[model samples]
Target: MGNENSLREQKILSYTGFAAKANKIVYGKRGLRNYIRSFQRKKVILIPKDTGSRVKLDVIKHCQIFDVPYIELNYTKSDLAKTLGKQNISVVGITDENIIEGILKTIQ
Candidate 1:
């Protein structure tokens, strides 16, 4: 999932293995997280933690049109590599919402 095209679009998502790493580790902002959650299964859905060039056209369209910045973060998995295995991704999302949740939820 390490492609320049995906990197330009979203941050690489690292699998935060079995430790509920998303809500706890990555995200620390409540307001931002709640806002992002609202978009879930609605106007916008959180991209998988490892969204590569495989992103869908509609998601890409929304990200481009809305300027929402499709993003990810490999740190979540890296930090917990001993638990979740090593992630190949390098880039991850900024601490807005998606990455935060992924980090907290990603187990290790």
Candidate 2:
């Protein structure tokens, strides 16, 4: 793993059937209403990649331990500020794995 944080983010993305980017993920979580509406997958989550946030870190670890897919990027990491500098990210795409393509299509 290159960066532990990046690896953690990548792990979450893979389960959702997404490939690697920067050896990590570059997607949005709950910060964007449209992105939040994208998934209908079971056991999925949209967590942010912020280590300083207790809630995000704990949730990320739990998802990784369980092999759950998650969206891990946020507005803070977004160059366009697309997600409103997203904060308060939690459960997202918490559904099934099959719907991910449609989810990414809608969100991306």
Q: Whole-model lDDT, candidate 1?
A: 0.37
lDDT tens digits, residues 39-91, model 2? 43343456444424766665566566656555656423332122323334333
- Please, what are the lDDT tens digits per residue for candidate 1 over residues 1-108? 356544433322333232234432222234334434445332222344444454434455545665444434333334433333444322222333454455344321
**What total of clashing residue pairs does each candidate reach?**
24, 4
lDDT of 2: 0.42
Candidate 1 — worst ten consecutive residues by lDDT sum?
A: 23-32
Best by TM-score: 2
Q: Provide the overall lDDT of each model, using Cα atoms, as 2-decimal numbers.
A: 0.37, 0.42
Each prediction's TM-score against the native?
A: 0.26, 0.36
Q: Model 2 off-target regions past 4 Å?
A: 1-42, 48-52, 76-89, 96-98, 104-108
